[model samples]
Target: MQIDLLRRKIGLNFNDGFAEVWLWAPNANKVNICIQKTEHRLDMLAKEYGYWYLKTEQIRPFDAYSFELESNTDADNAKLKRADPASIYQHDGIFGDSTAFDLGRFEWTDQNWKPIAVKDYIIYEIHTGTFTPEGDFESVINKLDYLLELGITAIEIMPVSQFSGNRNWGYDGVFPFAVQNTYGGPQQLQKLVNACHNKGLAVILDVVYNHVGPEGNYFNDFGAYFTEKYNTPWGNAINFDDAYCDGVRTFFIENALMWFRDFHIDALRLDAVHAIKDFSPKHILAELKQHVDKLATENNRPYHLMVELDLNDNRYINSQQQGGYGMDAQWIDEFHHTLRVAAGQEKTGYYADFNGIEDLAKAYNDAYVYNGQYSEHRKKKFGVETENPGEQFIVFSQNHDHVGNRMLGERTSTLVSFEMLKVMAGAVLCAPYLPLIFMGEEWAETNPFQFFISHSDEELVEAVRKGRKAEFSAFHIEGEAPDPQDEATFNRSKLDWNKAATGMHKTMLAYYKTLIRLRKENAAFNDLNRKNTQARAITDKNTLFLTRSSEEQIIICLLNFSKNQQNLQLNLPGNMSILLNSATTEFGGPQPTANAIQHNGEISIAPESILIFSN
Candidate 1:
């Protein structure tokens, strides 16, 4: 069998300890290869094809190994010292050797675990680095008990792949298979997943398959892994449909499987799927879905593959039987836009297209603003009507990108009134789709989630700072952008765990706990079947009423967009009872008044408030 190595001219014979290492030297006639393992000389055997094979019987894990390729013709030949591309454990840095440890050494306690179905999922998207003060996967395990108590069924962690330097947001990952060495590596991640499962929480990892980081990317030396056929905002798009695309697709699929099989991750939240351009007969997304389904079936677990697409394309989440990409769910930006616009908040960028109560109603009912209609933002006809059920959409009041992309990374709580925040949370948790909460969103943490990275190159740091400032110019933000490379940027992003037990944070946490309890206990909230959902506009541009009902029970939700109180008339056939109210002081409301007002054919609504009535 012939296997092409990644880079350099290295050939190894499994039958012999001798391997041959070569370099293309058109001007030189003689060359020598020197192998060293942490100052120890190893016996090397010369083999054909200019390869030097060394005996590995004495080599153990974490052994630092490097080769010095010399040319006899030039006494001052430049030495080539490179880390193993297949290295599983990198302790000091990128310069390490491949460990031959067995992956099955760890004993997993989640053999009987099964993931919660997509319909029943309540995901919490968190960054492991900033989720806790400790900033590691093990620290996340220490916090899983809180998530379970808060009723989150799934934990969607941001990317944790290996990237340059010790710290980053993880989007600039260069090694797709290796876990970040700074984050305690593969064994630590496995422990976190097992801990989550033990607490009845599923783990979903966010993966970036659009483009690899510029630094530490060596795939080009091995094969044609990129092309100029397509481009994206980030850079030249990944070569998904060009020559050798099959190998690239397999690499990603295998990486996905590794997360599930090796680390026990229950699902994957594919980052920016729209940027993943592919024109193959079987789209890369479909191919990935097929493999994921097979793996799920074989393991007898509810494994899901969710997508983050800005195109508003419903085909991505539609059923596979209907000839659509078989994604379990997709992020619904419409929901966030509607709530933001209705609350009379930020109007920059995409939020410009969403305003007034009508848009909010449309987003809540149909889950899309375009729906085959003309879009003023794109200045073209966009988005197909989503035939998928509501559960196919993952709705959120705020996420990492929504807040972190801002000029100062201000959360929704910072922009809206305290009462409005509760109303937004009520709307989000009660919606038909699966809901997600950003890390500090539950308690309205005041700390900002700034964009931070640790790059070794000073030039790259300056360029990033300048780019961020330029990007914010369109929004008319004042002042200079914060330096992403600054240590303070990363330190500020860490969650102050002490806040969770005091003041507004405590109140917000209680509110979230109550909402979760209501959702779990009430049949009306838990029933995801679309037939039970019905929306009625109370005012063309100020208020809307959403009613979800199950057999012998009904939940009516009234949402007021106005900033002042308004008198609302109820025309229901049955008696009504107030189950939840965002206007209460318990949820940062003004004060507790009439908790339950009789139908009386009329009800008064506070400005920018939400009311949930059940009978």
Candidate 2:
């Protein structure tokens, strides 16, 4: 099978009391294994298909090693050498030597764990660098209990692949297989995933398969891994369908399988899948899904493959028999745009296409606003309407890109009032699509999630600082874009975990926890049947009404987006009682009167609040 043949014998593998090292250097005439921090040297014999192989008993676990190659096609063949392209762990830094680490042994406690369905998952997205004060893997493990108490079913950690320096957003990963050395390396990440599984929570890792980072990338030195034919937002695009593309496809496919077969993760959120340019008959995504589903069946576990795309295309989430990619779900960013504009955020760039109320309604009623319609922003006819179920779309109000892309990466609480914050949360928790909450959003953290990076190259650092400031000219707000290389920028983004116990922050946390509980335990909230849900907007009053029902019960959510109070007499259902009131005094608001006020079909909604009633 292709999955088994991908990662086999590519790196340092130990078997039968000997270390077998294999390297795929098609252009090299000679290869040598240099044991760093030691004086041992070994020569490799060239095998079929230009593969260099060597077996030695001198190597031990955690031994640092590198390769020395000689080839006339290489630019610096006699000058310097590169680290293993398939390194699973790196020591010192990304530029350091690869280590011989074994994945055969770990005290994993999640033997009977299985993943939850995509329609039932409440994924909480997180960035390890800014999630805690220490910015490491163990720190995140310390707070898994807090997530469990909040009724979260899964945790979607951002990328942790090895990057240059110490700080990054994980999109600029240089080493595809190696875990980030600074983030406690491979074993530490294993511990975190195992802990999450033991807590009855699934783990989804975000993987970047687009353009490689600018520095410390050496795949081009061996063969045609990149192409200059196509231009992306980043520089050269990866050569997925070009000459010698078989190896390139195998490289990324192996990376995806390693996370499932080796790391024991439940899912993978592929980053910027639109940037992955390919024209082959069997697309890389289709191949990946096929392999993953087979692996999941063999292991008797649940697994999903989700994608992030700007194309607004249904083919990514549709079934394979329909001539689609067969991905499990997609990150529907239009929900975030609609919610932001509805709550009065800046309307510039792509936000100009959305007008809040109508678009937000489209997001609930239909999966896309631009389906079979002309986009004024793109100045072209875009998107085809599809019968793809709403459960295949993942929606959120705020995420890393929506927040950190701003001049100041301010949270929604910084842009809107506390009551409106609850309003947005209600829209997501009670909607038909899957929901994901960014880290520090539950209690409305006051800190900003600004973009930050640490690069050793002085020239590259200056270019990034200049590029970020220039990119924000299209948005409102003045001044500089905050130097991403500055240590203070990263420091300002760390969450104040202690704030969840006091004042308004504490109240918001309680409100979120309550909403999550309803999503989990209540049948009216989580039934995936489309006929059970309906939404409408009262444009004149700036109010939205949503209903979700089961055979036994019915639930309604009312959200007011205006600053003035609204009193209305409307025909509601029978036997109504309050389930969650965002304006309650317990949640740091004015203690409203008795919540059951539907007598004679009359009720008054407070300004900027959310009221959920069940019948």
Worst 10 residues of 1 by lDDT: 5-14
What RMSD does each model have against the real structure? Answer: 5.1, 1.9
Task: For candidate 2, write residues 165-226 as lDDT tens digits.
Answer: 88888888888888998899989999999999888888999998888887688877766788
Question: Candidate 1 residues 501-561, lDDT tens each?
Answer: 9988888899899888888888988887766787766664377789888897899998877
Please give the distance, in angstroms, between residue 83's alpha carbon in candidate 1 and its true position after superposition: 3.9
Measured against the true structure, the TM-scores of the candidates, in listed sequence, are: 0.88, 0.96
Q: What is the lDDT of residue 422 in candidate 1?
A: 80
